[model samples]
Target: MRPLRIAVCVKPVPDPKESNRLQIDPATKTLVRKGIPLVINPLDRHALEAGIKLKEEAEGKVTVFSMAPPAAEQTLTETLAMGADEAVLLSDLRFAGGDTLATARVLAAGLKKMGEWDLIICGAESFDGGTAQVGPQLAVLLGIPWLTRVCQLKREDDNHLLVTVEDETEQRDLLAQLPLLITVDSAVNQPRRLSLLGILAARKRKVITFTADDLPVDLAGIGLNGSPTQTRDLFTHESTKKVELLTGSPQQVAIQLLDKLGLTEKGAGQ
Candidate 1:
C-alpha cells in the first residue's frame, strides 16, 4: 500500500461569533479587520479534518496551506494543533486584498513548488466570501478533475475514492481518481476539537512561511492589482421584526390580518 499525500486549503476568518464587531472600511472598501480574533473558516476545518482522517487511514502525510496575511500564522498554528502534519503560510504584502482567483493562483503556485501530491482538499465555500470559487479555480489551474460539496468520501483503493457530493436538490456518488481536488462541506464530518496534548505537540513543529518572491509566481497574476473583480459597495441591511399576537375569532383574525396589512378601508393604526 502506498502512502496518500493530502494537501488541505485553509482560510482565516473573523470569528463569526463576534461578527457584531465586524465593520466595513468606508475608505478602502474592505473589512475593517482589527482587534477581532481570527479562526479557521468553519467549512475549511471540515476540509482539514477530511485530509487528516485520510492520512491516518493510508499512513500518509497531510499538509495545510493558506494564502493570508502574517497575522494568520495563528490560524495555521491552530491547524497544526488539530493534527495537520505540516503547514504552510503564503504571506506577502503584495498578496493582500486578492480576489478568489488571485488567491487560487498563488496557492496553485505553492502546490507546484511542493511538487506532486495525491490529493487536495478545500472547503466548499468560506463563511466570509461564500463564493465557492477557489477550489474549482485551483483544479482548472492544475488541470485536474475535481469534486465539490463532497459530504461523504471512502477509499475504494490507493488510486481511487468513492465520493458523494450533495446539495439541496441533488446528490451524486462517483468514483474519483488520484491527484484530484475536492471541496468538502460541513456535512462531511464534525471537525475534531483542538486538544491540550495536540497544542503541546504542535510547539515542536514549525510552520513554513513563504513570501511571493519565494514561489515561482508571476507578479502580474497576484495581489489587489491582479484581481479583476471590483467591489461595488459594502453595506449591511438593517432588519427590524415586529411581532403582534392577534387574539380573535376566525372572521376577526382575517379582518385583523387585512387591517394590519393596510388592505382594509379602515387600515392599520386606525
Candidate 2:
C-alpha cells in the first residue's frame, strides 16, 4: 500500500510583544511584519503536531508548508527539526501584504505542485489576524471535503478516515475519506517539544523554496494591490468603569456577582 501523504500548513507570526505594536497605515492600508521577531503561529504549531502524530501512527510522510516572506524560511527550518519529512517555503515580494483570499490562492498553488496528497492540515486560526479563514478558504480552492476544529483523528484505511471535532455546542464525529482537509483547534494534542535528534535531522533536510513566479497565480487578485479588505484603525482602550471589590464569603460573592449580572437568587445559584 502507498504511504499516506500529508501536508501541514503553517505561518510565521511576530512575537506577541512585538506584534502588539503593529500599526496599519491608512494611506497604504497594508500590514508590515518588518522588524518583528517572527515565530511559528501558535495554532499552526498544534496543527503541525497533529500531522507529525498522524504520520507516526500510520507510517507516512509529513511535509510542512509556509506562506510568508522569504524570512519565513527560519520557521520552516525549525519545523523540519520538529520531525516533518520536508518543508516548503512559498515566499515572494509579490505575496507580501496578501489578504486571506490571496494568501490562500497562492498557498493552494504551491501545495498543488507537490503532487497528490491524502490529507491537508492547518491551524484553526492565525495569531496575527485571528481570521480563521485560510484553512477553510484553502479547502474551497482545493474543492475537497473539509472539517474544522478537529480534536482527534484515526486512519481507517487508504480511502477513509475518522475524526472527532468539538463544535460550538456539541461533539461532531466525522467519517471522512482521503483528499480531505482538516483544520485543527488547540484542543488537539499538545505539539511535541524540540529534541536533539530531531534538530539534527532538520539540519540535513532539504527545504524546497518557491516564489510567486514558480506557482500559477492571478497577478491582479494577489498581493497587497488585490486585497479587498482593509483595516480602518486600531488603538488601545482603557476601561472607564472602576472595579468594585466585593469582600465577602464565596456564597456572598457568588450572590453579588449574580446580582450584578441582573440574575435574581432564583435565577442564579441553586
Candidate 3:
C-alpha cells in the first residue's frame, strides 16, 4: 500500500498559566493576544501525537496546519519538533477576527491547495474559544465525513478505521472510511515531550506560510466581515468574598445563623 497521508490541524492559544491576563478587545470583540506568550492548544498536542504515531506505524508523513498570525510560526515550529514532517501557517491581516466558520473556510482553501490526504486530525476544541466547530465545519467545506470527541482509534486497514467516541452519557464505537476527519478528545493519548534530536531536526526545516492572496478564498467570506456571529458584549467577571464571626452560646449562635439565613421559619419544628 502507498504511504498514508495525514494532516493535523492545530491552533495557538494563550498560555493557560497567564490566562488571567487575557482580555477581550472592546473594539473588535476578539481576543487581545498582544504581548502574551502562545502555546499549542493543549488538546491539539494529543491530535498531533496521534497523527505522528499513525505516520510512524504506516510509513507516511504528517503535515501540521494552523490559521494564526505570523507570531504563531513559533508554535508551528514546535509542532515540527514534535514529529510533524512539515508545517503550514495561514497568516494574513485579513484573516483576523474570524469566527469558527470563517476560520474553517480559510483552512479548507489551504487544505485544497495541499492536495489529497487520507486522514485529518484535530483537537475537539480550542482552549481559548472552547468551540468545537472548526473540524466539522472544515469537513463540510471539503465535502468529507467527520467525527468528533473520539477517544480511541484503530486502523482496520488503509481505507477503514474503528473509532470510539465518548461524551458525558456514554461511549459509542463506529467504523469510518478513509479520506476522513476526526476531532480527538484529550483522553485519546498522552502527547510526547520534545526531544533534543527532534528540535535540532526541526531547525533545518522551514515552515511554509500562505496569505489570503495565496489561497482561492472569497474576500467577503473570510475574517471579521465573514463571521455571522457577533458579540453583543464582552467583560471580565469579578468575585468577592465576605466572612462574619458570631459570639454567643451554642443555642444562641445556631438561632442567629438560622435567622440570618432566613431558614428559621422553615426549620422551626425540625
Candidate 4:
C-alpha cells in the first residue's frame, strides 16, 4: 500500500457562546480576543474527522495545519486528541489582522513548507468569519482542484473515491482522484468527542510551530498590510424592543399609528 499522507487545515475561533463578551477594535477592525475563551471552529472538526478516518483506513498519517495566534496552540491540542498524528501552527505577531485572503496565503505557505501530501482537507467555512472563502482560496493559491460543501466521502480505492457534495440545489456524486483538496460540510459526520485515552496519547504526538519567516511567502501580502479588503465601519446592531401603547377611540388609534410610522398625510400634503 502507498503511504497516504493527508493534511487538514483547522482554525480557532472564539467560543460563540461567549459572544456577549465579544468586542471589536476600532483601530484594527478586528475582534478583541483577550479575555475571550477560544475553541476549534465547529465545521473544521468535520474536516479533521474526514482526514483521520481516511488515515485509519489507509494506515497512513494525518497532519493538521493552522494559521492563528499562539494561544491557538491549546485549541490545536484538542484536535490532536481527536486523532491527528501531529499539528503545525503558523503563529506570529506579524500575521495579525489578516482577512480571509491573507489567512489563506499564510496557510498555503505553511503547508507548502510541510512538503507533499496526498490529500488536503478543510472546513467549508469558519463560524466566526462565515465567509467560507479560505478553503477555495487556499486551493487556488496551491493550484489544486477543490470540492466544497462535501457531505460524504467513501473511499473506493487507495487513490479514487465516491464523494457527495451538497450544493444549494442538489447533491452531486463524483469520483475524485488523489492529490485533491476538499472542504467538508459540518453535516459530513458526527464529530467524535475527545476521550481521556486520546488526550493521553496526544501527549506523545508532535506539535510543530512556524512563523511567516519560516515559510516562503511575500511579507507584503501575508497580514493585514497585505490584505486588500478594508473595513470602513464596524458596529453592532441593537435589537432591544421599543414598545408603545395606544388606547383610545378607533380614529385616534389610527392617527397615532400613522404618526408613529411617519405615514401621516401632513408631510405628503405639503
Clashing pairs in 3: none
Assess each prediction's global lDDT (C-alpha) against the native: 0.91, 0.85, 0.92, 0.88
Error (Å) of candidate 4 at residue 11 is 0.7
Order of all candidates by TM-score, from best down to worst? Answer: 1, 3, 4, 2
TM-score of each: 0.91, 0.84, 0.88, 0.86
Reference-based lDDT, residue 201, model 2: 87
lDDT ranking, high to low: 3, 1, 4, 2
Predicted structure 1, TM vs. truth? 0.91
Q: Report the candidate with higher TM-score, 1 versus 2.
A: 1
- For model 4, residues 1-270, the per-residue Cα lDDT tens digits are 565789999999989899889998887777897888899898899999988888777688888999988888998899899999999999998888788999999999998898888889999989888998999999899998889999999788878768999988999999999878999997888889999999999999878999888998889997779999877888777899988899899878988888888988973342
Q: Which prediction has more favorable lDDT, 3 or 4?
A: 3
Report lDDT (Cα) of residue 93, candidate 2.
88
Minimum summed lDDT over a 10-residue window in model 3 is located at 233-242
Candidate 2 structure, TM-score to reference: 0.84
**Predicted candidate 4: what Cα RMSD to the true structure?**
4.2
Worst 10 residues of 4 by lDDT: 261-270
Residue 253 lDDT in model 1?
Answer: 89
Error of 3 at 20 (Å): 2.0
